[model samples]
Target: MTLAAPTPTVPLNGDFWHTPLYTRTVDDGPAVNDALHALVLDRTRTAPTSTVGVRNADKTSSDLLRWEHPAIDHLRGWITDAAWALNDHVGAGRTPSGQDAEMIAEAWAVVYRPDGIHQLHSHHDAAWSGVYYVSTGHMQEGTGLLQFVDPRPSAAAREPDRTPLYTIRPEPGLLVAFPAWLRHWVTPYQGDAERVVVAFNVGFSRS
Candidate 1:
C-alpha cells in the first residue's frame, strides 16, 4: 500500500493547554463517502447495534475500520498520520514518521437516524480522540452537533448562552480530534436522512 500524505491540521484554539482542538478536512470527500456508505451499511447488517452510547442508532464495535476496504484503509492511515502531526505540533516530537510510526489506533462507525442521540462520554484510555463526519444528514438547527464540555468544574458561568459548552457543526470530510479526556456528546439528530460518523482514538504503541 502507498503511504498517504498528511493533511494540514488547523488548531481551533490557540491556547493548547486550555482545551486543545485539532481539525483537518480531507479532500477526497466524494470517493471516501461513497465507499463509507456501503461499508457502514454492510457492517450494520451483521453487527446491529452494539449498545455503546445512549442513542437509538446503529453502532459498531471499535474494530469496524479494521476491515479491508479502500476507504476504511484510507481513514485508518489518515487518522494515524494526523495524530503524529498533532504530536509534533504540540512539541511532543513523538514518532512522526508517516506510515511507519508506531501507534495504537481504533475506530468505530455510527449511523444516527432521526431523533438519535448519544450520551456524554470520553475516551478515557486514549491520547487523542476524534469524530469524522461522513454524512451530516439533512439537519435543522441544534441537531447532530458535536458538543464538548469544559473540563474545568467552575471557571466563569455566562447567561443567555452556555459558555462552558462549545459545539462544532458537522461537515462531510471534517476530522476533528481533541484530548481524550474531554467529555463530549452529540445533540439529538432530527435529520430526515442518516447521520454517519466515524469515532476514532489513537495512542502510543505499547511495545
Candidate 2:
C-alpha cells in the first residue's frame, strides 16, 4: 500500500490571537481546581502581610511563589504547550533572526476581595499572560470576565469610529492568551463569594 502524505504542522504566529479565549474541559480540571483552592488557602493562612491595589479597592495576594509546588511544574508544561501554539502564530517577526523562542512561567494568587477588582494593566516583562479561574459563586456571576483594551491610542481616540474593546468570560476550565503588553482587568464581584484564579506569564529567551 502506498504511504499517505504527512500533514504539515502549521506555524504558531499565523493564528495566535485568532482565538483569544482558549478553553479546555479536561477531566482533570476539577481535580486541578481543588488542588489550586487548597494551595491558595494554605498559603493565605501564613502569607506575608502586605497590601495591594485592586483597581480602586485594596486587596492582598499570596506571596509570589516561583516553583514552590510540584503541581506548578505540570501547570507550566500545559502552559508551555499552549504558549508554543500561540507563539507559532505571533512569533514570526517578533523574534530575532536566529534566536530560539523562550517561555517562562510565573504563578500568583489574589485573595479576600469583597468588592475588589484589579485595574487595567499589562505584564511588562512577559510576552504572554493568562488566568485560570478556580472558583466563582453565583453571587460572583460574571466576575471573571477578562477585558482587553485596544493598543492603538489613535484608533481608540477616534470617537464613534473607535475600535471596540474585547471582553472574555472564562469558565472553570477556560484559559486565555494575549500579548503581555495588552491592558486588561477584572471587574469586581458583587457576590460574597471570593473569586480565585491562577495567573501566569510566559516569554521568550534569547537562545
Candidate 3:
C-alpha cells in the first residue's frame, strides 16, 4: 500500500506570536470584567497592599488559581490548546521537556491603568508564560503593548547599537505565548481607558 502524504504545517516563530492570537469574543466580556473588578476590589479592601509589584498604578497581580473560577479554567484550556498547536508546528513531533511547556502552572490577572507598565524581566521558576488580553478599551496610545527583547543581542555585533525587540499591541480576547526565559515588559499605557490582561506561568508535573 502507498503511504499518504503528510499534512503541511505552518512555521512557529515570533511573527506568529500575535498573527493567530487565540481569541474568544463572548458577549459577556463586560460582565466578566465586572466580576473581575469586584474580586479585585474585595481583595484590596482588607489587605490594601495584597496587590504587589511595581508598574501597578491602579494594577494588581493575583496568585494563579487553576480551580478557583470557571473563567480561569476556560482561559487555561485555551492556552493548553494553543500551546499544543504551537509545539506541534515548531517541534515537528518532538515533545517539550522544559517545565514551561508542561502546562502545570497557575493563572493570574493584571488589572490596571493608562500609565501602568511592567519593567523588563523574566519568569525564572516557571516553564512557559502567556498573556490573555481581557479588554482593550478604545484608545490609540499605549494600551500596554507586550514587548519582548531578543535573547541574543550580542550576536548582532554589526549593529551593536540596535537591540532587537518585538511588540504586540493589546487586543481584546488575544492570547500570547512565549518561553518563560524570554525577557519581556509592558509599555506604559497612555490611552484614556484601562487595560486588563490575565497572565499565566506553567510548570512541569509527572501526572
Q: Pick the candidate with the highest TM-score.
A: 1
Ranking by lDDT: 1, 3, 2
TM-score, cand. 2 vs. native? 0.74
User: What lDDT does the true structure give each of the candidates?
Assistant: 0.77, 0.58, 0.58
Clashing pairs in 1: none
Per-candidate TM-scores read: 0.85, 0.74, 0.69
Residue 74 CA displacement from its true place in model 3, Å? 1.5
Candidate 3: worst 10 consecutive residues by lDDT? 1-10
Q: Using alpha carbons, what is the TM-score of model 1?
A: 0.85
Clashes of 3: 3
Candidate 3 runs further than 4 Å off:
1-53, 58-64, 90-102, 160-163
Error of 3 at 79 (Å): 1.9
lDDT of 2 at 54: 64
- Residue 206 CA error for candidate 1 (Å)? 1.7
